[model samples]
Target: MATITAVVNLDLPGPTISRHVYGHFAEHLGRCIYGGFWVGEDSDVPNVRGIRRDVVDALRALGIPNLRWPGGCFADDYHWEDGIGPRDQRPRMVNSHWGDVVEDNSFGTHEFMDLCELLGADAYISGNIGSGSVREMSDWIEYLTRADDSPMATLRRANGRDEPWKVPFWGLGNEAWGCGGNLRVEQFASLARQYATYTRDHADNRVYRIAAGAHEDDYHWTETLMRSFDPLDRDDRPATPFQAVSLHYYTRTGSWAEKGKATEFSTDEWYLALSRASWMEELVARHSTVMDRYDPAKKVGLVVDEWGTWWDVEPGTNPGFLYQQNTLRDALVASVHLDAFHRHADRVVMANIAQTVNVLQAMILTDPESGALVLTPTYHVFEMNRGHHDAAALDVHLKGAPEKEVDGRTLGLVSASASTRGDSALVSLSNLDADTAHTVTLDLRGRDVVGHRARVLTAPELAAHNTASAPETVAPRDHDDVRLRDGRLEIDLPAHSYVTLELTLSPTPSQPLVPR
Candidate 1:
């Protein structure tokens, strides 16, 4: 068997992996809100106060730390006031951004906050800046978070919700460089500063405002935004314009017009998909360098608020729904992107996958008419790697690089990231090669292995996915190809698989002066 060796140093610690890094994004596109997650109380969709119960329970099980709502360009067009009063009296408008579908102001602020509360997840509210006024944005914040007897707060109370919701994260705008407003970097920066200036704090909830940021490799946008905040510490600048700036990148294989379907793809497309997924590493590294140049202190974070594979909408579905099947390739993509996020946790404080349900690389797929929900392969990967949240990332070194060749380009075969919390350590490993199984020898240096368990997500075919008929077509299974003996862990990793190994480490010896 082809072998790859790795040594994980328990003593060498990297940055603390933030739980918020495993965040999710929920847009108001297609069925993501209406039929996917929020099937009204009157519907027979097994809902908890209008929110889908199965979706809520599934996301809750994954320990979702935060969820960004009503976005992906939808936030820019949304007017918050129209969605607050009685449902029957609410105004309806066309969602010109996605399929031009009619958006009945049914699922608004209250419904979103309720869903977040139900899932025990933090709400990252993306404010409307493109078509919304400063007063409108300010009043929206006041309505949700303000606890005082202000006019907006009073209106919120009269709407039926007496208590204020704790909205911790706020996006001043989203994608201002494009659909957000088509504004230049400086224009977006100035408008963001002005809009963020009036957004007041309520009670103890101090919102973390995120300025709309760059598209892929747009270094100038990052630089300009950073320069805009250069005088933040000075007496003249506004009150710290933003706590974070976002970067949006998607792993879109092939052309936009010819974007391939989610499941029906050749092995060539699979290899190309893996290659595109690996680009995230370079993006994060280059973006971090630019961010460091401007903010040496690393006070501001780099939030990847929008990401994931954007394939063509599923066949026969609404072209704007962006519904795509999740396969083992997507699972591997999640592993790759998540591992990159963990490595750059020092600066990449938070990231929200493009969407959470019925969208690009969604975690759960729901058949609204049938009330059937199926967890995707990407969901299992997230569930398996939950231990990495809030843990300290550790350094791991590989002895030799395992590689695979697809077409003319060579791609690395493995991605491994380790993290420790208290006495337990978790390691996530992915073999990117589609046809090579690797037996890996992991040297658990300076740690006594007490217990070990493995879970793997893979399938016989690269394009295997769970359809409504066969929901378990590509699900996780208990893996026994791993063994821990005398501090060394041996894993027989399968091709095109993502595995998570949980290890219970014993305390290190108090006195140690020997160098191996």
Candidate 2:
């Protein structure tokens, strides 16, 4: 029996948490594209323009802000021209990065943009720099975004599309230190400057170019990028033609060859996953410190374009697909990382979990063999905490909270962050203990909260997940564990649970809510 106390001040506002922080990444690996998102219009699986209707509907419900397509090492090797024109005429290529499977080029640029349009999300295109030429990259940009009658635009129109799509976010390259290009930081910076310079803005589409950033605690990489780009600034303006830098880190328990299983972990591994995921706070803090040295005004945003737990592939699944199950552990991981992002909203403008479906820590998993799709625990976390989007983060402090010892390490018993939207304040809390439920006393800084609603995502087992056989076994349910009396809120936070509390403050006089 443990009790934790926290205080939140709604008046103290931080940066508006970017909705793009909830963005999703979809790569060209495994069933992530072919079997997960697209099922062909002729198939028995209900589909919209060849994509699974259930998948599209689920993502739309999540209010997906943006989607990054065609890479995680595949983008650098992909040639956009081969994916255009007629489907039969398109050439099939070997995806050297993932499983060595042949990519039919059936779902290419057109399909990705179409999917984004359907989801009502912005498109973040990761371009090829490892094996693509400057002319090719520039032409691809023109073909998708150019409004004028250029050769690439004309070719695009001749293919089928009458109007160009709006692609606001562009990745100069992905993982240049490894898959994108095996080059030194200086060489990569040189290429980023050149390639990003040619990524033009057509019509109303202003491109926000993001430089390829460090993998983990690569402080030198961030320092080198900021230094190289520093010389490109003139009159407090960027001359390098870029607006942001990207960061990627994945949570893993063991070595790549011996990574632990996803849904078969013990309490120790569960704590380890959450503790490692919490490292995003340190990563963002240190990286933003480096970015501040060069761009103190915070003009250059830090985009965590790829992040999530990565585990060994499920049994009998293709190893290259990076497919794994999502459980309550993953929901906690999402909570910690999201809370960190909210706490660091000043510098962390956006973050995309890797990825959206049928991939590492995916939101939705689709069974191509059976036409079944189940939303994972990670999906419920996103759906429950969607209120933080576009809301001003409020100041929150936790005290009298102790740490739990697990497997030679200690982690906080609880983590919390708050945000204010109009007349309501949203508070998200995570209880990391595996056995003990904590009664949390929330001090609202004298704000009059007339009403409240809450939802909790938890299960009796730590490894509990939603399978095709039992899709609703692990989902969010209306929580009634909160009580308010004498202007103080008390919450019974179940162990290993993620809770979201929406407090309605300052209700109108004509329609006052009854206090409970």
Candidate 3:
């Protein structure tokens, strides 16, 4: 085993890691909507007005901050009016993006809002800009948030909901450079400003409008969008059209033509996945640098609304469904990305995994035939790291950390991130090596540790994953090999594992940490 030393500077706190950074996405793709979250009210599966009960309960336990809805490529094609009226009266449309399946419009505005309420999560709605009009987007906002007797508000009342729903986040479009519309960055930036002008805030429900941003390392797309913010309105004030920009990245071991299998992969692929996941740090840094030239105060956020592992579909699953198995490798990929998000908390305000249930890198997977719900290994990581939500980020510096060579490039073998909330602190660690364990010595500075507890999630094999038959195959368990001595903490992390240490700290004179 290798030994590594890390320093946790608790006193040198950074920005508050927004709880929205722990957000989730639920698109109208494949089983993600129909069988994953919504089973008809008359079905045998237990549910709360068509929303799956087990799914909601499982997500609620993770303290899910927000959920982005009706998206990916579907949001641009979706018309809000088709889903508002009675279920039987609603129109059916072909879901061209996912599968050539028919969308019954069963799970629409009301259903998504109800699911968010059931999980105690905020709604992040993505509007249609590719195939819909500006008035349509504006009316949808009024329909959801207006308190007065506007036309859209009256329609919302007739549909059953009396009070206006609070929509905290609104996405202008999904991917304007591709499925959203094959438009250039300049075209989309101009449209974003025009559409955002009418996405009015109604009553007490304020919307954080997020414009669709670049993919991967497209720095030019980000520059074009940020340049549009230079123009001032009539009052000589900054005409910032959007409060944030969206970035989408997926950890794929293979090319887009052949996104490797979810479960079947060699050791080289494992290292490659983590290597790609770690690239998030560079992406955020470069993008934020571009945004800094425009808004030096860092008021705008970089919302990674869609990110996760995107492997090929399971053997028997439909290609368009994107129903892939979540293995221990996928869990590590999530940890690496989350650590990047934590490190750049100042600019990376919010991030939603590609999906929540029964889709690409889902937190929960469901069996359509048997209605068996199994929490993915990725889900356990989110539940374990929930303490980092809305906490002040603590700088963690590591020395002598091991590294592995993959495809002629070196990949870090260990990952760590820390945060403090009140009298408690959380440190998340991951060991990317698949064969050897490592011992990590944490130097705790500026805080006296009163108590500590640890938990680890790992499997017997790298490809081990959860199934309906054996749900806890790769779940978190209490780890007792953690000790604290003389202001130093030591933990034995197993190979291909994720661990979280929670420490109870003695109060200090430095200011009380406030959550954003």
Which of the predicted structures, 1 or 3, would earn the higher lDDT when compared with the native? 3
Over 1-516, each residue of candidate 3 has an lDDT whose tens digit, in order, gives 888999998777899999999999999998999999999899899999988899999999999999999998999999999998899999999999998889989889999999989999999999999999999999999999998899999999999999999999999998999999988999999999999999989999988999999998999998899888854323577657898998999989899989988899998888898888888888999999998887777878999999999999999889999999999999999999999999999999999998999999999999887899999999999999999999999988889899877766678899999999988999999999999999999988887677788999999899999999999999999999886555477899999999999888779644332211
Candidate 1 TM-score to native: 0.96
Clashes of 3: 0
The C-alpha stretches of model 2 lying farther than 4 A from their native spots are 231-239, 405-410, 507-516
lDDT of 1 by residue, 1-516 (tens): 677888988766789999998999999998788888888999877789889998999999999999998897999999999999898899999999998989999999899999999999999999999999999999999999888799999999999999899999999888998889999998998998899888888888899999988899999999888888855445464557788999998886778897877888887788888877877888988988998887776888999999889898878988888888888889898899998898898999999997899989999998756668989999999999999999999977876767767556677879989999888889999998788888888887776666778888999999888877899988888898886545467898898898888887767645322211
C-alpha displacement of 173 in model 1, angstroms? Answer: 1.1
Using lDDT as the yardstick, the better of models 1 and 2 is: 2
**Where is model 1 poorest over a 10-residue stretch in terms of lDDT?**
507-516
As for candidate 2, its clashing pairs are none
Q: Alpha-carbon error at 221 in model 2, in Å? A: 0.3
| RMSD of each candidate relative to the true structure | 2.8, 1.8, 3.1
| Quality of model 1 by C-alpha lDDT | 0.87
